[model samples]
Target chain A: MNKNFNFCIVDDDDIYQFAIKKTIESLNLTQKIIAFSDGEEALNFMIENLNNDEELPDVILLDINMPIMDGFQFMEEYIQIKPKLGKKITIYMVSSSVDQTDIDRANRISDVSDYIIKPIKPGKIKSIIEKLSMQEN
Target chain B: MKVNTNSEITAILATNNDGIVYQFNTDAETLLGYSSKEIIGLEKAPFFLIEEEFNNFRKDIANRYKENLDSDPYKLLAKYNGYDSREWTIIKKDGSRFVGHSTLTPLKNEHGENTGFLRIIKNITNQKETENELLRKNQVLNAAEKISMMGHWQLDTIADSVKWSSNLFNIFEVDTNQALRFETYFNFVHPEDKAIVSASFDKSIKDKVFYDLLHRIKSTSGKTKTVQLLGEVLTDNAGNVIEIIGTCQDVTQQRMAEIKFKGLLESAPDAMVIVNDSGKIQLVNKQAEKLFGYRSQELINKPVELLIPDKYKHTSHRENFFSMPKTRKMGEEGDDLYGLNKNGIEIPIQISLSPLKTEEGLLVSAAIRDITIQKIAEKKIIEAKNSLEILANKLTIQNTQLADFAQITSHNLRAPVSNLNSLLDFYNIAETEDEKVILFEKFEIVINHLTETLNTLIKALKTKNETVKNIETIMFDDVLIKTKEILSGQILKTGAKITTDFSQSPHIEYNKFYLESIFLNLLSNAIKYKSEERAPEIFIQSVIEEGVQKLMFKDNGLGINLKRHGHKIFGLNKVFHRHPDAKGVGLFMTKTQIESLGGNITVESEVNIGSSFNINFNK
Candidate 1:
């Protein structure tokens, strides 16, 4: 319970980003929270903080539909740079699609922790973080 | 010497055993035109005879008596015996000759000693001339029969005998010396034709009618000949058939020619009608009968026009055929030909005519083919092609609609609804009034985005459903100018340089609105995604590729990675570059507008070198 988690939200929907940030802040276990409008912004952030564990996110909530680089495209770029990173990041694909193709594609990526359909409940975020913390322990 | 007989009709003379004339009668003097005053003792029978004939007789007598006979009339005449009479060439004092019957006799004394020979000659020249004429006639008849390949025969029914002429024996390949009988003639008949021959003969005899038949006969040399036999029954005064006289002709060559012609006619796949020079149908094959629905006998001697439909009868090319006959298709002037069958139904037909030279005269053979099924099949093929075109068009439209529906449901509609749900969740959990107000504002933005997406989807669906009717000749340059005007703000901001060359294919037939929209979308995308290293340069040109008019929008801008995103480049809400205005709906909408009007949009690009969007207009 004393452990703090840094969370990242990569999505084009401003309202979803704001809601999820608020939800995570209410948990009291978040030490830092960052938001990117699309996958490219989040990927750039990850490359800039490649060795800085404190700045790097512990969990990434990635949206599938976006104006620019989508979540799947970001995952592709992320996988290529993942070996140089100082920290292991848990990524979850978040979409409102509910389309089997999207779900299947996200699941096929071994780096992706899970696919979560919107709107992601606050308890779901807690469980994801708790699961990650447990694995770390 | 003395002669034994003396008469006015006969001349008597006596010759010593040495052939010297001793006594001469008045009749002999009259016949020879020499008076009895010419001493008989000085004359001899050999003196009046031809030397060659006398010598020949002397040799014949010498051989018979086994003695050397001299040129004496006594030895030549008397050596044969008591009364020998034969034909002789007698010469008179004037050297005129007559064929005479001569008699020679040997006079013997009481001691049976041969004294001399007495001879008598008869005037039989008239009778000999008649006999010679008969012999000459018989030779001429034989020659005529051989030349014509015809032989005559007489069968005596009561006598059970057959008399065949020499030529008849030649025809049968039998020896001329062989005696002919009824059975001999029957044996020459071919085995296959035996029953027919027998029946014909029996019928002719019972009915007392003339018999005529054509049958095959195998000759003695194993050669087969087709013979035409014509027989006439001869009746006696008592009304009984006395004989059957017939003539047999070897007609094998003629028959073979006829059979070959018939075989060719029957083997033809098309109906054949052989017409004489007079335009009459001389013959018809089985196919002709079947096609015209008439018996062959019914068509023979009928005018060829009978089979033609009444509408085409006046256009008969009979005269043209007779004038310059050759092998050619009939009525090749692009007019369809029809034949009227026996049932009065007209059938489409193609005809070819060929000249047929026969012994009787010139003939034309017409070959006819029915094309009803072919015509129907041709019509069906055209109909099928039209239906296939329609089906392909429907499939294309349906595919576009399906893709639009998927895009709307999966991304555009889903994202905003989910954002609204998230905002509602935050609003429900807000602890303060300020937080609730913030959530409500976020809700408003999400709703507006959802509304905008729905409206754009409705417009795209309408474009897909509406049949494009506003087709006009649109200049590529005009569309580009209008698009530049609409995107002038972005063009000015990015310093995009737009150039065009519409000389190759200057204009296209397409919906003006769709053309404008396509131009607007492509030009804005070029300026919006301009490469930071250089000013955006877009070259819009109209060119003809493979006979299709293509409008190319090539840009030197921040191009996409086609290898990675080529599949979904025009997909709804699919954006590759991180740009603020990249909604990903412009290209999708442009593609939809183009494809709905039977055109298509394709993009070729590299990572950063450039991108080219080619629009193929409606053909």
Candidate 2:
């Protein structure tokens, strides 16, 4: 695993976290798959782990539903921190909801590369990786 | 009343067939003032009766002598004078004329009068005058009897005999031939009044008191009559009470009038407080008692002020109630007047006081009606209006605040977002994955978060009451088609199948925008909550009932445990799914949109089998 490639997975579900972790491990695409259970915990973790040159996640697989801080709330906090990280973090809004609002919101964000409905398979993760590579080129 | 026979008596028997003098009766001679001496040979007789003086007599003779010979003596002499005959009078010795019946009959031999010409101009001046005087007296008596509604009857106490005048017999409906005995007359008294009649007789005869009383009488044919018997003690100085003389009058009409008048007073709706000049209540009906909440006994003899509230206690209207002229209505002036209840509570009442006048003086009567319930209903209406005004002001304030929020969230961020997108597109390429991932992820994450925040703000904005629009019929198929069209890519990607059944034609009565938003949210959630193990299957259907339309969306996805998250399922940002894409905005917006359209959404879910969302809308 490349230490330069650190990634984050924010979701409330253990099963979804396992699936996203397995997909990332099979591809061995990043150094550390930092996992957080909710938007608030993941937001605190991101604030503590900031570094100037450390590469932001090549991709982030974010689950929409959480207890106190859902995906929408996490984005509110995460979007403000993105300018300081100064690193490209490709986000794929992953959810079991094919809801238009989730799909629409993911499409609306300039930072978000695309939207994907879970459970995230290896192929979907590869597709997200391809989108990041395209941005890099 | 035959006084004496005359020396010459000649009878005139005349009819339309023949004018014959059979033998003029002696009374005819006396009536016409003629003897057999001068008129026996003369043609027109020495007596002449003036025509003007005997007009009715001439007509009587004509009527009786037309075809049949009348036995009436007056008619017999009357035929001797014809229509052209003048001066129906008799001549005395000196030729002085006196009104009388004159007869000229053809003298007959033994066959049937008409011997030669027995011209008998009998003067009946004195006799006719006496008959006229008797008739005049009888006419006056009849007139008096009719006017007084009275008739006379005589009873002989000795023979137990009763003799009634014509008017008296008429009252009993009997002929003169029917002997009236003491018992027969007593039998005429009504059975109900027999005792009274008997007592009256005892007082009149044995006790020597004047018998005057009102009682009922039963006639011979069993007809009951109300009558007044006024009699006096007609006795010699011996005081034998020889015969009872009395006048009886039918008084049934008067009695019935009294009964009906009493009934009217008792049944009248408006209270009749017959107060004397002393301000005392004399009569109070049941309605009056109920209106004032006092028993008639309690109200009577009490001053009318008991009913008047404290405000009018010292008023002149109360003091001079008895002195006022008889005015049928009270409160000619419009004023808010009231009455006091038995419980001493003052009830608002429309009071009308009236003066009932009699020969005795003026009386006051009051009509009171309670208006408490009407006053209360009016007060409630005023309160409701005040509440509605407050609600309107609060709604206006909330509406302006919402407009500001929408501008800051959706529009304000749009420009910055657009700039970020453009800057990213213009950037040069990086060779290394580490360098590119670092920068790209930062901008991407920021934009994504901004977009999600904006969408939540929009959800909150839609729930405000000020955004409610005019109601419209929501077509089931149209809304479903539009929402599905918007999420078509998501549907294809999830491998989900969506079908609609509107067999019942559930076109909801709702706002069009709200219905569209509800449809979009429910269908999207069905696809979003799909179980990983299987392809999603969703059915959207509707049902119609009496006045309501129900929409149902069922999905073969991971269902929720209603027992755990039931209360918060429709709440804002209340998401339960573990899926990474579940933003939790869809269900919250769906609930609000449904409610704003005057409808409700309910979910039935089990963790894995399936979930069903039902929406009930007014039609």
Candidate 3:
């Protein structure tokens, strides 16, 4: 299961955050799951630990809508500092919006590996981790 | 004295003291239309006299000498002796009258007693008729000269004398009795024109050519007249110029009319070109020179078609115009016309033609106007109209997208539902009772969020669908007072200083509830996002902008960075600041309400400085 792999969740809804956390734990995907209520918080954490690969997550599930900053604003700031980061992280856009414009926009970013419409299934989460684990091998 | 009876030029007749005719000369017979045999003895001298004239002469002689000479014709005849004569109307043998100058002499005896009178008669009718014809012709010439305002003069250069006809004296306003010297005519020439006139006259004499010129003359009456002087130099048999004779015509009226016509042409707004019936350019005004880049002399006598472009040369427009001349525009509407200048550059032009009736013949005057600037303006107007249509289409598309966005945002119902789905999946996989109970608690929270979101969406929908029916004139001050009272706690807590000046446009016709709500939302927002370093100083004003009633709310607050979220400032669920009460619903609802009644709301803001929101009311 590659339990050592760390995952991050950026969303403003606490219930969705809690549900995703439980699903990851239930499959024993990782014990090092970190969550932020919005893109700004996750960005601040990533900036604070830019060279600290051990502190940074291997993957991030980003929400499109939030207070303070959204997924697109975070990506704009992240891309500027991406070359300085020690970890090669994968990003997925997780949004409740089925709008083609939002989906197409998130997919156009080279850093965004995939766009997933919520509710994101546990099966989708497991595959994401497994894909990362295969990459590490 | 003895008479020469063979003299053919004179008539000889003799009358005795007793009034007996003895002999009629050969010339007298021809002069009196009679032969000598018919009148030698058949008629006495009394028979030859015109009775009325003889009676008048007899009366005058009796009054003077106390002698009635009626029967004693010889006594009257003796009064006129040799070398003395008197004109007498003589009756001929044919009873036709002949006027004769007759002379008388006494035929005396050796004792010197008067025996009879000898009278000689000479016929003078031909000479008298010639004198009367000359007098009639002279009177006719004077009349002609007076009416035409023209006079003739002869200058005998050799004699240094000048003879002027009567009208010539009138033209110079000089006394007719005044004698004219050769220099007298030159004195009347205007001072400015004297040099030219003298030079022309000298040239004529030196060159042996005639002088014809137009010059001004100031008459003795101080009246200035324009005169056309034409003179010819006459040479004697030896080829010496002996005399100069000419006519001077008063052309003042013609010259004045010409000057006025030229002034009118020069004052026209458009270029004027006058052409004769043969299509030859006769004159061009100053404007034509400026327009075609040609001097007037260069265009004169040139074909008028020289100014028309070569492409238009084949049309025969000028020929058609001359055939039936009238005042009209040159071409059909929308027909592009061009002119070729001296520089060979083509210019867009408009032309109007009018016929000029002149003594020479029919002429056409064309007024040309350069329309290059007008053409350019027309093109720009068309381009502007096209761009405006494009912009209008873009706005329409943007409006459609905005409506779609509103619909999508209201479907925020999906976010909570998706959360519930995730929560349910987690519940099904829960192995422990404690974990299941926690998932249930989380489910309740999700459901509550879902309920709250649904309520908000429904309220937003209601706001969008609400028809405004309670329109009334609501004073801005009244609305502000009520809003302040409602927000009294927050105003006092924050120490917000709200000032207002609604004197310019104090009130608006708007829905009562909407006005109060708008005032409440804006004022609360001002106090809510005020800068912590300073007390909120909010300024509210009402004004009429370009005849549209507007309300402005300005505040010293933590203004939004419009650059970051300007497009979504009034969008649903779009919030900028991290205030605890920031729900992002107030502005969106305010915009929807204002727009429902065909009003518009716009905002200008700077971070940490201030925000000014302007609302334009429809009514």
Candidate 4:
């Protein structure tokens, strides 16, 4: 696992956040992990540090049901600054909702690679990374 | 044997069989609508007149063979369905319908026994119409008299005597009530006019001159009516007038609405024309000339129908106006109809039809207003509405596109993640018993997560992408029967009581397949999620509101907490309670199917109480 490849998670539920964090560690997916309680904080933090060469996360798990600046709104703003950051970044949508509307919205964004329902685990995380590698080649 | 002529005896001196000149009569010819020549000289009666074809007026023949002629033939004519009866009908020479009277009687020889028959006939058509009119006049008198031709009166002298005309009674609707008398005359003259009438009469009587005046009278019923009285005193050679004779007419309604009608013509925000019944322009204001390109003086004598389109000219005949009887029914005016313009261009107009009685009779004065600008304004409104509809459609399309994107992303991404997680967790399970339990938990968690993602997709589609399908009149019992058949054994096991009543009639406009799904899903859920207290009781009935038909299915099963999960009840796999089979998918699918068929579902429920779903379908 590369420590430089930081993972960022934005989810409102503490239980979901804890589970994703535990799965990341158990799979040896990455060494560094950062979490935000809501979409607004995550988006703000990412924009403020967008200029920093190593500040951007390699992967993001964006939750749909955040209180302010929902995942869709964050994606709209975040996509504008993607080239400026000069980094390989992928966003995977995460939510407890099984609503197709949210899934379809996530699929429409090029930067969003996939969607995952709550309680993400090691095996699911590995498959996402593998798919990303395949696409990059 | 000629009953009235010695010459006929000379002719029997001419022919045989008693030369029955006895039958000769003037009316007998007229009664059959035929000539006396056909009846008198003919040996055989026309079979058309006799009900018994070959019998040849046989009963009359038998009586004639016995001979007695003095009996009145008219009553017998009616009895034998003869040509001279009081109630007579004729068969025309062309075999068409006719009206006539017929009679029959016996002719006797010197022995005083019956020998031959004599028949007398009369045609009564001329009197029929007069009596029929008498009948109609009795039925509704307002229709009997032409209400448009009104009249007025004036008493030229002071009064021990007075005068009246036909129309004064018409205005009072008195022609129908009682016999007209000099007192009936006083009953119609306005009370205020009474004093004026007396004063004017005294003045006129002293001078022996005529009186012309307008006055109001309180009719016998105390209703005030306006009347114009115009007449002179009729006198003997002494110049002392014997009595006052005059025309009294009601002008109440016209006197009130005339000023408004004139004002409406000039300042009427629109044009107007008043045309007499003969189709000549009686009056036209400035606005009308401006609209039609002709001065009122120029158009005055021209036919009013000239302003109407050629297509409508055929419809503007006086006969059309005369078709409906002239009745006293007021306020339900004739259509504010159409007319042509001077330029021969048809312009939309709102007309008011009123009757004016000149010496000529009723004239229809049309108060017309042009609606061209109003039509233009309506077109503008329609254009705006069309643009707004386009905008709404655009937004709906965008919304649908976004929903599709969400559904695809959620469904596509979850599979790989769940499989990888389960595979890794499975390896850990074999290492130790504690690890095995942990691995099983991990596997369950990943699978549940995957299931929820799939469910979200289904739920979103249910709410958004459901499209309408075939619509038909779906019978309630048939749908229920199909549902019961599908879940027949399950229902038997659960022992759920499902009572149905169509007594109020639940058949409505709906798709058969969708309606079937609606009942199936609901009943299945009721049995699947039964409240454990006792056997479930489900009530199903049809309801209607404002022409919309609804089917209500209420179950006494474990109900949902509407306050918490109300909005998401039909969401995919969003299970309300922890039942093993609580996938929450049934409601989502059911809702989709129902909505696709242009129907709706609404739920009202309380936690652990009961739930009732009312489904309304398009009619």
Candidate 5:
């Protein structure tokens, strides 16, 4: 796995965040994992580090249910500032909702790479990492 | 008297003074239809007449000459009279009598003394018969003229005189005794028609041909009548016009009837086509001309099939209709009839047919009405109904989906199962007691969340299933008072000011528990989401909208960002505010309660300004 890659975890649930971070650490996928309690916190960090390549994540796991701002709201704001970022950011919608409406809505957004129902498996995380590494190659 | 022998007299006869047979000329024999050998000197004048007429004539002679009266009146008249003239009925050989005028004269000798008389008679029967025939013919002609409202006239061009029959004077309403001239007839012609009539008459005289014209005449009675003048010029052998004889017929009433019929035909609302028995178009109204896009003259004398579409041209029903015609509506049910316009465009039409009885024969009149608009309107109505059904089906599907979503939430098994799987994976790979313990703690938190979600889903499902059976007439003021009481602690802590107006619609028929819960949830939500920049000011009002009772809850609070969260505002576990007490189940349950009773809830909000929730209660 590429250790130079940065990953973002945006969720209100701390347990889901811990699990995702621990899984990334266990797989040795990256040491630069950044965590946000909600989409709003993640969006604030991205906007502040628009040109900071080292601080911005290459990949983001976004949760639909949050306190301040949800995944869909973050995507709306992210689209407006995405052109100013120095690197491409891959976003995956992660939620416990099995509702087709939510899934369809997430798929319809061009910025969302995919939708992963919680809780994501280690194999799924490993495939995501492998796919990113292949793209870089 | 000596009888003068002359051929000028058609017939003659002479008798002596003794009243015996004397002389009968050949001319008299021929006039009397007798042979000269049978009557000349063989019979006396009395022998040629019937005894009844002869005796009456003799008595009349005796009375006329009383001084010479004797036993024989003829002999006495013959002796005394110098001359006398009388009409005698002479019997013919064939037993037919003839009327003859005879003269009797006294024959004088050279010594100037009275002698035997000579009777000279001539037959004037033919002349008298002709006179009586002419009189009869004149009377018949007068009667004919009066009955037909026609009069005859003779213009003697050579004499420059005009003679009008008695009926002509009557037609002009003029005295018959007055002498009428050509100028008198010309003056009766209407001023507008005077020049034309005069020119026609002059043309006839110059060309020596027949003249036939229809013109308006203003009679002496101040009545205008349409008259037809038909005449022929009488020409001599040398080709010189001698006279002009004509008859004038009053055609005013006939013309008026024709005009009235035309007006009725044109005034009909539908296109009227009058066809003869041979299927030929005889007459068409203005509407028919306009509908078929053809001129009146173009359709007349043409086959009626020209207006029918080609598809129906060969239908035997058309021929059957003519064979046994009657008043009936055309086109059977589910059979569409169309008309072909002059431009060959097919147009939908409805037709009604009726038979017209006329002098020539029975004619069929078809009334055609265009139904293009009706067809289009029917199509539009069907299309609209189909679209409305489709929309209704979509709504039903969405409702089913909502139910399925509620079931899924109540199960709340997906997240817990996935979390347990992840935790088990972590425990299996932990290799350390601390790591396994950390994973176990996380499992507890996941279980708690699952249980909380399931409980909230159950409450929502209960609100949805409680269908409106507990409906009661609840007062808005009472509900507001109770809600205020329940939220008194928060209101005091936040210094929330609440105002209400329920005068317009103070009460509504709704479930009491649901209504109270709605009131409490909306009131607390307003205070809980209040903006810190100002004190909370909440306004509650009840009003009737579109015959439905509605409660409006408005507050000065940190309003929701509808653009981002509008679609999921009423969803279970959907939260927008960061308040510690925000559980996100209050509005969802409120919506469930409203929708379950066939009511609805809508919101209008601005960030950091205010939010208004409108709830319409079921009637």
Candidate 6:
């Protein structure tokens, strides 16, 4: 129910992207839900919208395994341009892998807020949105 | 005059003043080896006396008469008032001679006038001969003493005089003419041995007993000599010591030779054990004492077998060694010889034996060396090699398992499950029956694919687990032939030309099923991804690299961009090309099978030129 929040989904799976976007729309969590097939596209959007607070997403769901510029790689590049950004961003690493190595690597990055395993449930998304709203207050 | 008739006594005779034969004696005849009856009147003093003695006597008589004023005119009147005596050599009529002593007295008338001279003579030839013989014996004794480096001495305690033999003076390097006192001989004694020698001499004199002492002395020439003094006190009937006689011998050379022998024994590096022909230990070096942990006195004169190990104790090797009497190296022919120590510890050893010929008999000298450190080093090398092999084996197993887990997570478990989740969400939100039916149909397709991936993963996992137990010697040529048969349809469709050469390394010990699967996967992948611009050409060959068996699969197909996808080239569901049939499972399964058997799979590729997959089989 935080309709004012902006959401971003960076994943190469079209079906997962469609389901996550629909869930966010049904919950009335945000007016804008930006989607990227991979981490490189998501990073380019963030870099292009560095000065635009309204265009920047408040939350990004970053998938770990991708063809080009994976979730960890985006986090490395994002840190370099972070000081130029006009908005504060919260990132969640999303992956279907139950690998402890992937979870530990995502947690070691200070930029990544948490890790979520797929398929992400609707209730989990709602709680994440609620947690971000509380942070706003 | 009458002669003394005792034959052993002096013989006497007399002559008238007129120098005519007048007397003869039995003792005189016997001494002169002549008959007195033939020479009494026919011979006179002139006949029996030597010519020189008679002339000297006449001259002496003339001079004496001239000194006397009142005398008769006779020649015999010279001794009228005097008596004379002289020693004379007289010759008998037989030409034999005797040494004589004669005395002349005056023969006078009633007017006291000189009438005739009376002569007395004695033969003393035997006494002179006995004295000369005694002198010759003394010279011989002196020569023997000088040659033997020995000397004799006498201490006359009553007279307080010390007499040294001629050789004693030579031994002390002093003049033989010089008088020797007890203190003079003591001056030559070494400073350290002086007190002991003096004490021994005093003890001998008091105890009236024999004394033997070994002491050192410094000669007058500044050279030191070892002297052995042996003395016995001479006592009178009252048990009082009167004299002490002793012999001293210079033993410097003998002592020095003993010291040099001892030096050589101590300086040997190895433990030296010197045993006599009877197997008794005659001598041992310092190293031997330390090695056996026994003192020199403890081992000397003891049986040499005490130092031998129990197993070799009963052997007659010691007797055999003496019989042969030759130098030999022990343990050279790989015999495991050991030496026993004082604490009963058996130590590995190498020994060498040599025969020492001495005055006592032949002795065997054995030099023993410890080899514990060498044996330990050899054992450690073997252990380290075995440990290294074990570590390599464990690392290989862990690597294969990790790759398998990655493959399961990325492709087999995630792909279909994620699709099912997406499809279920679509079906739940569909507003029409047609849309729901379409979603269900997609669900069926996703589930079927999930089953297929799961099945493939199970097969790969089974191959890994059973790789060792199912291993057999497989030929690369046979495997290649089978793979070609399986992919013949694809090979013909793509116009792929396949060639093979397994001559270099034809066979390998590996799981047969795994080998066949690997070949099939690689061949089909090559044909499926063949370059469209040219006919696909594939070369399969076996080679040996760095002592490792290798199978090389090369194809002119669309290759991977190693720079971008090198790390995950063999990863499950990791595709580098956009081809419809590029499932990214063939390489993953091939890598799993190779690694599970302790082998490795590596690839080199360009974007489109070619790709070469090499599998190195572990021995």
Cα displacement (Å) at residue A93, model 6: 1.0
Write candidate 1's Cα lDDT for A63-112 as tens digits.
98765577888988998999999998999999888778789999999999
User: DockQ of every model listed?
Assistant: 0.37, 0.04, 0.30, 0.05, 0.21, 0.17
Instruction: Report the first chain's TM-score for all candidates.
Output: 0.97, 0.84, 0.96, 0.87, 0.97, 0.96
* Best candidate according to DockQ: 1
Minimum summed lDDT over a 10-residue window in model 3 chain B is located at: B1-10
Q: Tens digit of lDDT per residue, candidate 3, span B10-75?
A: 777765555566777777776666787876665454567777876776666555556665544445
User: Which stretches of candidate 6 lie above 4 Å from their native place?
Assistant: A1-6, A12-15, A31-58, A67-69, A73-89, A127-137, B1-374, B377-385, B388-392, B399-403, B406-435, B467-499, B506-512, B530-535, B556-558, B561-564
Please, what is the TM-score per model? 0.53, 0.33, 0.51, 0.37, 0.52, 0.51
Q: Worst lDDT window (10 residues) for model 6 chain B?
A: B1-10
**Each model's backbone clash number:** 0, 52, 1, 49, 2, 1
The candidates, ranked best first by lDDT, are 1, 3, 5, 6, 2, 4
Candidate 2: C-alpha lDDT:
0.66
Error of 2 at B11 (Å): 92
Lowest lDDT sum, 10 consecutive residues, model 5 chain B, at B1-10
DockQ order, best first, reads 1, 3, 5, 6, 4, 2
The residue-by-residue lDDT of candidate 4 on A1-137, one tens digit each, is 23335788987545456557767776775747889976668878877887664767778999875543567767887877777776678899987558866678889988888888765766788887666666656
Candidate 4, residue B418: lDDT: 38
List model 2 lDDT by residue over A1-137, tens digit each: 12336678987655345445655776877677878887777778667755644534555677665565667667777889987785666676766665565578878877666677554556776766665666566
Per-model TM-score of chain B = 0.57, 0.37, 0.57, 0.38, 0.49, 0.53
Residue A18 lDDT in candidate 2: 48
True-vs-predicted CA distance for residue A90, candidate 5, Å: 2.2
Q: What is residue B328's positional error in candidate 1, in angstroms?
A: 33
Instruction: List per-prediction Cα lDDT, in the order shown.
Output: 0.84, 0.66, 0.83, 0.64, 0.82, 0.80
Off-target runs (Cα >4 Å) in candidate 3 are A1-3, B1-411, B431-437, B466-468
* Chain A TM-score of candidate 4 vs. true chain A: 0.87
Better candidate number, 3 or 6, judged by lDDT:
3
Model 3 misses residue B514 by how many Å? 1.4
